[model samples]
Target: MASRALRAVVAVSTLLAAFTPASAQEAVVNVYTFRQPDLIKPALDAFTTETGIRTEVLFVDKGLEDRIAAEGENSPADVIVTVDIARLSAAKAKGVTQALEDETVNSNIPASYRDPENHWFGLTKRARVFYAYNARVPEKVMSYAALSDPRWKGRLCSRSGQHEHNLALFSAAILHWGEQRTEEWLRGIKANLSAAPSGMERDQVKAIAEGRCDLAIGNADQVGFMQTNARSPEQQEWAKAIHIVFPLFENGATHVNIAGAALARYAPHRDNAVKLIQFLSSPRGQQIMAEQNFEYPVEPRLKASTVVQSFGPLTADALLMDEIENTRQLASEIVGRIGYDNGPER
Candidate 1:
């Protein structure tokens, strides 16, 4: 099983030396994060050791931006870390975040991964991938364009087309295929739904394991989570039932979305906040993130942990995340306009 799982990830490469801590008064940085505290503890610990600055964290699953806004200018939050461009953009739109002007952060992260306006910076990337029932599906590779084929009608499963994951996926479609063709793809997927798109990607995988469908769509990191799931052993069976394939756009690039961070607008410890963010993009911080969460690091030279590399090689798209993000609203509208969640028209 270790050998099998080992092959799932493709080792990305290692990182350079850790960065020198920035100059700052010994102070505390208050954090508001949507990610679990334990997931980021290693990097946070390293930050303290390097900078002599303590970190106080507040963890929440959602509404991070809204909560910061509710706290107003006096909000203690210095940094806000969360997943998805939707949330990151929402924080910027709500004026809960401020533009970060730091050369360390700018140099560590490429322009493609950060907001053009510098409101947020990406720390990691994850792929939207396809899962096939190993015994029933012989194909090892898939293209997103092929999902619309009639051969897959009633044999495919996915979460709602409007979910942020799918919306991001479709938004890429808009970039690669244009609106008319992307609309056609959505309609075709709707026509092919095994049942009305419902539940999460896990549910779609569960259905595949049960033989309700032969193919499913889901995030690659999710499979990593399911494989290592100790609390719910049944998830292991779901992971075992399928092999993941990185789906490519028409231009031959896989789609990836970011998990990034922004500075709180009223950050009381502005200098400390900049240090934490820069450290996060540093080789050491990126290494901690890659190993801890099993995600691809935003740093160009860092590789994913052995466990994550097992998922497969990810050839992320040339399209800037901001480009994909720009089209998400249109993607959502298309999902709504076509009644994507209502299932194939009878």
Candidate 2:
């Protein structure tokens, strides 16, 4: 009878151990991200290896803010990772994220790349660059303002004007050129579209290859991905057909967008989330992110991937990202007001 009782007790204990919460059993951080999993796997894996804290990510292509809001206090999200200042600002505005006050995070990221309130921190940056067909537009250097010239009329392609990428870029334009000029500029770009703004940045590049357009606006990393054969072999041929031109404002600096993160307001593992954020901004984490994603690291000390560097040095515009966030709504409004997505004005 004593032996039987001991056996039963052991079984009960094993069952309890098996049912224990994952966090209690071992460290884990849950991430809700707009970024794709494959793009960030290396960084997450390195974080887990370094800190023994595993990461589980949920990739939401859209409606990330709404989902987090719906989950409320019970949200399993410990961190939020996304691209563009607009999305990060949207998360903060939705009250789904809390301010981070960690010294490590503050030290690793520059003031320009982090929220003044510490709501989010940028991990990497990608310049908003122009890709011109080698056979069509020969000049290696170009300006964003030049894209509006009548000479390039009906020769340009872009993704939807309302895309977060373009919105952020337009926001910067608004800040630099003010509303009236930016509006006029949008109309000019609208006049130049080869087709309706119908696809992503990659499609714009493809458009250039197909002779649908001679020049297109896209992020530098997309160009890097193509140049490095990160996509299909055919894409390498497409990449070969174009030349990357870093477009600058009249002020002589190029617009840039960031891939960034924030701590969830209702993080279940707040401490672990802090650790992850710090690790992401650390030298090792920054290196992993920059190399894997083909983006420039937010840490000035780190170098961008070889493919990105081959494009030449980038002088990022000094405009405050917060200012861009402030103007994003107006930027979207202007895109709509000009019928920028309906293709060339008819």
TM-scores, all models, native as reference = 0.90, 0.91
What tens-digit string does per-residue lDDT give for candidate 1 at 243-320?
Answer: 998888767788888888899998877889999999998888878876777688887578888887887788888678
* Candidate 1 residue runs with Cα over 4 Å from true position: 1-26
How much is the lDDT of residue 18 in candidate 2? 46
lDDT of each: 0.85, 0.88
**All models, RMSD in angstroms:** 11.4, 7.0
Tell me the tens digit of each residue's lDDT in model 2 across 10-105.
Answer: 996574344333563359888888999999999999999999998888888988988889868767788999989989999999999999999999
Show where candidate 2 strays beyond 4 Å.
1-21, 229-231
